[model samples]
Target: MDTIASLFSFITWPVSWVIVQFHKLYGAIFGPDTGWAWGLSIVSLVVLIRICLIPLFVKQIKATRNMQALQPKMKAIQERYKSDKQRQSEEMMKLYKETGTNPLSSCLPILAQSPFFFALYHVLSKIASGDKIGALNQQLVDSAREAHIFGAPIAAKFMDTPEKVEALNASLTDVRIVTAVMIVLMSASQFFTQRQLMMKNVDLTVKTPYMQQQKMLMYIFPVIFAVMGINFPVGVLVYWLTTNVWTMGQQMYVINQNPTPGSKAQDAYLQRLLKSVTQHGEVRGRGRKRVVKDIVAKGSDRNENERRFFAGLAKAGFAAQADGTVVKSDTVSAEAEGGAGTRRQQPKRQTKAQRQAAAAQQAKEAEDATLSVEATPEDKPAPSLEKGPKPQAKGAKPGAQDAADKPARPSRANSGGARQGKSGQRKGPQRPKHPSSKK
Candidate 1:
């Protein structure tokens, strides 16, 4: 545990040293014998740090834009292999490689600054508690002690009053009011600055899940900072507020001048600012009116009028239903030919054989209906027609009845006559069947 602690301290020590040195340097340069001087010095330091990080910030912005622009392609890839997890992963990696942009690029700046932020917090806490005055260099500590502006001490403890040092402690009501206000402003500025960046500068193409996660952090981090702000010294709040302002200004400058294409703010700005510029420069006020006239000339208004007429008809219940189902008409002729209760009329040239077969089927159905009517109440359970032939009547003879019960045959006389006629029509002379009969 000690080893781990040592490792952490090793990493944090330089950050802490840098923060302390920066504070002392600002105090010396601005002669922080006044609160305003120290406040301005903190602002200067923030500006200097931000200016130095400008290049990295630009790179991060470009990377973020590139990531956003890739969203459509990424979505396409995801949709294409929605069912293939392995393939989706491989394709996503390949896409990242090709684009030379990481989704993590958006977080790089915050991650880089986290250590410095921690160090700044620690240094502020020390100053606020008044426990590290001797630890600070003699000259810097003395200057910080002397710092006062607007009758408020810069290095005063949370409950310390200017009157106490000036021999008027009994007369002063409160001295921490300025500190509390500065702390609130610090947290508020941070919140609004981050909120503006997300609302205005963030690229629209960033995935919704990612944007939602970022929004969660945006609120969560500010709340955490606000809670922590109470324990921090007024000097720390000054630094934080200055930093937030610098960030806001820097972001505004970048968005106004070099905004990423398709970003929310960029789109809005172009629509409001660039549209008017181009119109005035190129079209001389006639462009917009001419465009509107052309749109009117294209028959859109006529189409809309037609749609309104149809809509009115529908509202009055006169619209036709075109949903693929056949609607039957109430009038006899208007009724569809094959609708229920309507028989289709067949063409009248069917062959005799077809007519006979249809007549037999009808006759069989009539006989079945007659039999069903004649059946006794005791014979309620009828056998399926599909099973086999029905049982014979009790009084019926076996072979003779079977013979009689068979389906009726066509008349032999008519069949023989037809055969004889067909034979007579053959184009050849008939021959005797036997030699003996011929003799």
Candidate 2:
């Protein structure tokens, strides 16, 4: 670590100078020899460096956007010169030049901070060594060495020997504990930042190896940081932890304000913007108006979130215009075409003869079903519809014939003896008469 830090000694003066200035301000509130003064000085330095790198960060965002915009052309170039690597490279360079995009811009912030980062590491190492370096003279180095953060000196490290820790007026236990906690915090912040970028700021509609690789890195990066953090001096850990926290916060702000297109964060941002627009009857900000114009230009190319935005506008009786304005139009928004891209299936057409045949078959099935139901046996037989003459008595009873019609005579059949009932069965108990019934 010392060897690596020493290689960046060219920037040691500036890095130490910044730390000293911050320390002066903090040393007034907290004692000059207190851990808070030295520790907060490192944190402030990180904030200062990040604030200076804002322009680079913005350029990185712009450069990434440009690259995304040029992807189609790049793909076409690749297809055209796929067999010729040299030609493909030439064409790619031409496109980049035409678009005035620097691919390396995305790495500018990290590259720019490298010198300062190592220089700080170098300064902290000097303090730990009890040696003077850059603006950290002997007195400053001594003060830094004596300053302990939670019983661990600012210059102490997790890997330092117990004897070395005691020499710096701290126990090995305190140094390891403090450094371990900082390492964990730094790693956690880095992981969270990566996770948010993957989950919310990236277009997740498509699955690809690159996305899988990023998901894997989301876990792998923290482990890398944790492994590297143990050797970092307490002051260096303070710098790394503060910068990690800063990066996480900055990423959160970007996700909330200006997320990538077609991303979940963009969806949430546009949702809130739409609510405000609907409530106010117009887009509230110039930035939002520009965003709306771009989405309108996308037309069918807009993402599902942008489609939903149009749906909300159309539902509220407002139509989006090409100029990024909403007008109260009765016509529905074309962008809000619910499943219009899909085709509805229609049934096959039938000929007149076929239709008639279907109807006849259906009628035949109905007739057959009716006959089946009617043929089923019932508990009681249906009343007979046919009429027949009544049985006449054997001897001149025929002339007396209409006995069935003689209302004044009591009919023996009505006496409830063995006789034909309405159901054609003997319904009453018949007394076997004394031998007279047989007669």
Candidate 3:
């Protein structure tokens, strides 16, 4: 253990330095005596490491796919060289080189993190023993000693010296409770993370040695962590737990966005996409930086309401037949065609221009109608059946006939008739004047 720790001393120094910086950053907010600060410091370290490992995670996925693609060829090589082990190994290496795929690339992320894991474990273990190591000054060590999470010091362990246990006022029960809970969480997270990769990311079409190894690691990692997690200081446990959670989330994101082809995750992704298009009228694909915007669906860009309307029609026995014509009885067809069924009618909306024009036309017709009625009374000819009797000559009787046929009367109206000749006769109203106006 000392030799291993010494070998990782280079890594331990840097990891310890960064962790202390994070601890101070959080401790300023959460207080130096609070375990939350130390716990958060571990989480910060995990975040930094995972951020750096993003490229490796992407490469790891690519290498894994490349390896999966070579599975058939790998099997053929093994069968062709079944009698010769050395040749088989050589062919495998050649194949890996030609394909630019590293057989160990899939394990690179885990392997790369192992050094940091061990370095953190060593640092925490030393801190627990009150020994200052790697960027941990005496002041920092003393502060960490004072920091307790839930009354359990960040540097405390499941097993502690009696003096140290009493100094922290911590009981075996307390240690057991904290360590056991963290252990369960760590183990369960590791188990599910590996299980997710196995179920969703791995291609099960070919059963190669690589797949068997993956399957083995899936079970082995969880069991190993459950047993070893008890010995871990709370800080180290916090680190591993945080890292596991990060890995799980990262893996899930990659699986969802760019899942391994022919895997369960891909199948699920396709199903979800199909369901999205089926339910909604729009779907989108990943754009730059995976930004997505919905695209209009093909055919009549009918929205969800229209789709539901047609679905309702289908349910009501107005389904379209194979020839694309609606197949329904006359009554149902009439109801559907006449828009008298449960189908909602969309009222046509007139534009502003149309409304204005219609109003102007109506006003013009009203004005013309009023003018026609008024003009009818003025221009219409008077009603006529026969002519009335005309006024007679001055000496004519009240009911005298025309002068051409009736005789002239010698009366007061014509009293000057002897002095007046027929041509110069004095003519007056044929009717007699009133008594007042007789003179």
How would you encode candidate 1's per-residue C-alpha lDDT over 140-227 as one tens digit per residue?
A: 5455545664555554434545554353222123346666677677777777776877787776555655567668878887788777
Give the local distance difference test score of model 3. 0.74
Q: What CA RMSD would you report for each candidate? A: 19.5, 19.9, 28.4
Residue 50, model 3, lDDT: 88
* Runs with alpha carbons beyond 4 Å of true place in candidate 1: 1-32, 71-92, 122-136, 149-176, 202-207, 271-439
Candidate 2 Cα errors over 4 Å, as ranges: 65-83, 206-209, 321-323, 330-439
TM-score versus the correct structure, for each prediction:
0.50, 0.73, 0.62
User: Which candidate model has the greater TM-score, 1 or 2?
Assistant: 2
Which pairs of residues have clashing backbones in candidate 3? none
Writing each residue's lDDT as its tens digit, candidate 2 over 1-439 gives 6788788999999899988999899999999999999999999999999999999999987886676667667778888999999999999999999999998997798899988889998888888889998888899999999998888898888998989999998888888989999999999999999899889987766544456766898999999989999988998899999989998999899899899888899999988988887799888778888888999999889889899888888877688788888887665644345445555767799999999999999999999999998885679888898677667767755547666655665367556654456676567755556965557
How do all the candidates rank in terms of lDDT, highest first? 2, 3, 1
lDDT of each: 0.57, 0.86, 0.74
Off by over 4 Å in 3: 161-163, 207-209, 275-283, 287-439
Tens digit per residue, CA lDDT, model 3, 8-50: 7789889989988998889889997678888788889999998
Query: Candidate 3: lDDT of 160?
Result: 62
